[model samples]
Target: MENLPKGSPKLINAWAFYDWANSVYSLVIATAVFPIYYESVTSSNGGMVDFLGITLPNSSLLSYSLSFSFLIVAFLSPILSGIADYSGNKKSFMKFFCYLGSLSVISLFFFRDTNTLWIGILATILASVGFWGSIVFYNSYLPEIAFPEQHDRVSAKGFMFGYTGSVLLLAFNLTMIMKPEWYGIMDETLPARISFLMVGIWWMGFAQYTFHYLPSNVYNRKPRKDFIFKGVKELKEVLIGLKKLTTLKQFLIAFFLYSIGVQTIILLAGIYGKVELGIETSQLIITILLIQIVAIFGAFLFSRISERIGNIKTLKLTIAIWGFICFAAYLLDKDNKYIDIQFYALGGVIGMVLGAIQSLSRSTYSKLLPETEDHTTYFSFFDVTEKIAIVLGTFIFGFVGSITNSMRNSIFILAIFFLLGYIVLSFMKKIEPVK
Candidate 1:
């Protein structure tokens, strides 16, 4: 692979702008608006609802839907990524998923009643696949667009942009939700639905800035007519090469271990607060907004810390902090006199590490990669690990909560995943940063 030029602030900023585009999906659809909306629409009578042929609890239904979506992505991303690398069309693939996800978000407007519950379920699945699928190609751009020394800062900048942009949109949505009458709308559901539409538009519109700057292929490969077969051949080569890339493999193992805890917690926090702790919807939104607001600073702060102490140690610090968060969460209860305060405290801690861990992990993986043209294929493996971890995490969390009828124990159990991540990191052979 040829070494591409880097240090272009304009290109870096343009690439980072995609985060500003897509993050509304994470905040508005996945984390905030959609879950609450789903519960309100599906759990209408406060009883089990019939989904397809099966009757299941509303929370379990959502969890299973998300797990199933991640499973699909995990299976498909590597093959698609291989095609993308061979075809020199990572940007186009990213754009395709962006459109699919955004359009699905807009389709969610019609999911207003129990009869249309399938719309919400199906849209959520498609929207999630769109978002996460786009991410595999997006993350591949890091090594090609920025120098190794700049990876931590650039990755954090992207995340910071995401956190700030999503927080702004989520805050606006919260206002519309909490004070629907202010907008001359009588039905609160109308504003929530409108927020979903806004997310779709916001995602596609800002993404054009990135699409304009990101090249079709940084390596400038000219794939032949047999590119489809070539793509599979390349992926097979990468899989075989993995045996010799011990450092990269070890880091991915550590990453997979921690993501099981981190991603699941992010996905489930709002629901757990609402269902288990009896927190109000408005309060949950406010708390999530707070986490995003703090995460911006956390991303920036931890990037600097990684610069000082090195990426490996910085990631270990985050792993330790996350484990503590799980233990602290286990102690929280609905009946406590200061339950809200404790919940907020947990949110604060989550805010502190959320961006730090994510930013550091991405940059760290980029640092660990060998100089190769198959970046999309390699990053596909990275994304696949996380998606599968999410599947496991959500499945375990939901299965435990269902059987025990308690979210607390489910949350506490996640501490073990973090501990395993920390131990794996401890043993990982540190590769020197790319010069």
Candidate 2:
């Protein structure tokens, strides 16, 4: 492939458009509608879910399933990313997972009742793997499409698009669930089922606009018959290279620590609100929407702040706030008179830092990567790092919640992770631009 010139507004926008395409899965299926739907279903069944012939608490089962999916992504990313780099087919590998994820989402339309519990859990796991697997390739594109200095703004733009697109679809879905009769649907579950269908359609349909413009085979490598093994070799090289990139290695350590808190919080916040705070479905949905709306502003606002304070400092600030959020969440009690108000207030703070930290983390890591053509392999490491963090975090959160019968205890554990991540970030030196 030709060496495409960087800083092309048209090209960069095309790349960012993928976020608008796929984020529906994040907000609707991963973050909102499905989790609530899963809980509501199992709660009606004596608050126990039958998982692979064993009954488990509904939250524990869901957490384990999600943790398993992230573990798959972590295992697959390194090898798959190597093949993509060696074959010069990064876009193809990305497209494969995008369709895998989107189609799996559409298949959720069949998950109608408790007896079909396996379908919901299996489909959710596959869709999650698809969503996260594609992200490895998608993130590898940042350094290729933009100069290092442009990384922050470009990364924030993608997230801004994501937050906006997901919120629009979620708002529409919430309306259908709140008033099903307006659509002539009497089936109590049909509204959410249709939302599942809509999310799949939205994800696949918008992605075409990105696929049409995104470059394929950018490196134009011609792989030999041994390309399969060549891919594994690519991973080994990155592992060796990381030893010299001390700051980047240090940043990943800090990122892993904080992500255990950040991702666990994002994944379980809905359940915590439902069971711990006794928040109604309507209030919980509204709070998530509020977080998404606030996150749009947060993404760009922190991007601007990073221009003055630099990425490391901005990230440290966000991590500090995340630690505060964890402690604040632990304090929320259902017996309180102003429980809903306090939860909403806490949601405001979560919204402020959620997108800021995420966008900055991706861009900051992109800026730190050394100049090389094996970007897919390199970013795979970053992707694997976070996915592994998710696995550990979710597993711990679920284990603690199941044993103690209190998710609040899980939140308290996450607070310590954030604190540890904050302390690690203090040692990171200012990074120089990759020449």
Candidate 3:
């Protein structure tokens, strides 16, 4: 493992630009505007229309489709990760996924009121698969780029840049859609569609910087082999790694359990505000903008705190804060006009902790895993747990909301997850990074 060139601004910028590129998908399509647009397009005029003689809210159908997409991503991610590792083509695989995702985002412009439901659903599934699949390889590259000692700072910096990039793009897109009159755009929807197109262009354009500057790994002891059999072998090795976690198994278990609450909030925060709290779409976009803006400062703050108190202590504090946030969500009024203020405040708190949790967690787990040529294969299990946690958390929220008809009540259940995870994490031994 050679050291990356110190103060190589191009290398750092290139790595960070990948974050910049992918975050557009997260900000524009996944979070702010598209879900609302999907609901609007699918809505009926208060009629019990039969789809195969079964009546359902268009929103429910959308949620179901989203959940199904997660399921497919969960199943395919590790397999694809294994294939990438075996072929030593993680970079190519990432590019393919990025292209698929960005193309799908741009194609959202074609989804009009007259578009078929299947078209929207198919697009969502393709985009989700690409987004989630690409992350496995992307995260694996962290250790390759930065040494163990530098992982925390470098990873945090990447996240900070990502949040900043997301905010910058979201600001432009929000202005276009929210104040189309000022921009001389006749139709608000046209700007919204153009916003999606911008995400694709931004993602495609910035990715080239990374591909140009980052050196490809050249150490190869074995020739390229059959991808199918190699993927299976890698999958078996991952399962074996999970089973071999004798002392650190408790830490992995805690991460797996607690991540459910973390992922649920990330995925559903915008939808919760728009649907349950009756927040206007523009207000919801502004709230997300605030999250990204505050998160930049928050990452720096946590980096300083971790320097003083250590990563484990900072993480413990973050878990405690998450518990309180979940409890606060339950207390917020479902119909309160001031609910957006509460959400904005909550987003601030989340911003303060998000980078710390992700950066520290990655560094901590990298220390725990064995040194292997197939590091990405093993890391795929970590990725799998994350996706599965998200799937389960979303499923739980949706199930509870459907049954109880209250998002607040469903949020109360998240506190239990946080508390249990905190307790589990407290018991695990401190992780020491490899020298």
Candidate 4:
């Protein structure tokens, strides 16, 4: 593998390109089309599913499945990332998961209807694990590819790539779905299933550009026969390392709190729109598309803002807006006049912060790290923190919706998390990454 010098533009952009490759899964499958498809399928089947021998509402079942996937990532990343760090194989680990996720997404084409619900559920879980699992290693590369002063711009650049790439593919997907006749498809469900296959293909096909450019192992370390045990030892050492880094620990606490709300909102917004507000599928997807379009600007704008105000304040600003979004969401009901317009307005607001916060959060964590080569091990903690938060958030969303039969109730409760995050963030001492 060719080694690029540190902080080179080509190297940084190549790292960012992976976001372009993989974010289609996040937008198309996790956020927009697949959830709507799942909802329609379950709605036709009396809105119920039996999974693991327990009957659950279709929406709740999907949320629970996502929560389960996050749980898997949370548990597995620490070990795998430690191994990647020790063996200098982080890129390999990333490719393995990417292939796993893309293949699983392709298999979702087999999920034709309620009868193949297991295919849908199983594929959803595996694909999610693949996307997020690969993300841990991908994120670990940030500090390696960019100077500290440039982390915000580089991170935002990645997200802009993600937003732009995802939107283009989703636009294509939406056209296929809305106008199935253009493709000579009369089956209502077949269009969505085809979209699923395309998402898989898009995810795998586009990733090759990144894989081609990215160096496999900068460290050049070889694994021993006891690499697994060595990896576990590294995991233990990072825990001790975390205990010494007070600011990073504090930031993780705040990040975890806010993520419970932010992640849950991203994952469930489609369901909330469809189930809680009775939004039409086309309108809901269009609103989500609007968010992706807006998020590109949001990421670029906020990255520049972070350079001026610093990452922590930028994050606090984004979180404040998130708090507003949660409250506004709780206020929405199906009975409101011009409800679609209101939803679109909220989608616009979400767009403004969605990419900004996610990009900033990753860079902020990167900037705060004590100088170390075990970036993957350190970032595994970060990814684990996020995955655990998502797990809790999705579980709460599902459990509350199951009990109250209204996801609006979940929205109301999630706002409190942001408030707590805001308070916790204030306690983190302001420090410049490059000072």
In order, candidate lDDTs are 0.88, 0.89, 0.74, 0.89
192-225 per-residue lDDT for model 4 (tens digits): 8888899889888988877777878777888898
Ranking by lDDT: 2, 4, 1, 3
Error of 3 at 300 (Å): 2.4
- The sequence of per-residue lDDT tens digits that candidate 2 reaches over residues 285-335 is 889999999999999999999989899899999999998998899988899
List the candidates' TM-scores in order: 0.96, 0.96, 0.91, 0.95
Q: Positional deviation of 295 in candidate 2, in angstroms?
A: 0.3
Residue 361 of candidate 3: its Cα lDDT? 71
RMSD of each: 2.3, 1.9, 2.9, 2.0
Worst 10 residues of 1 by lDDT: 1-10
- Whole-model alpha-carbon lDDT for candidate 2: 0.89
* Minimal lDDT window, size 10, model 4: 426-435
Cα deviation of 198, candidate 2, in Å: 0.7
Clashes of 2: 0
Error of 4 at 69 (Å): 1.3
Candidate 1 local lDDT, residue 33: 82
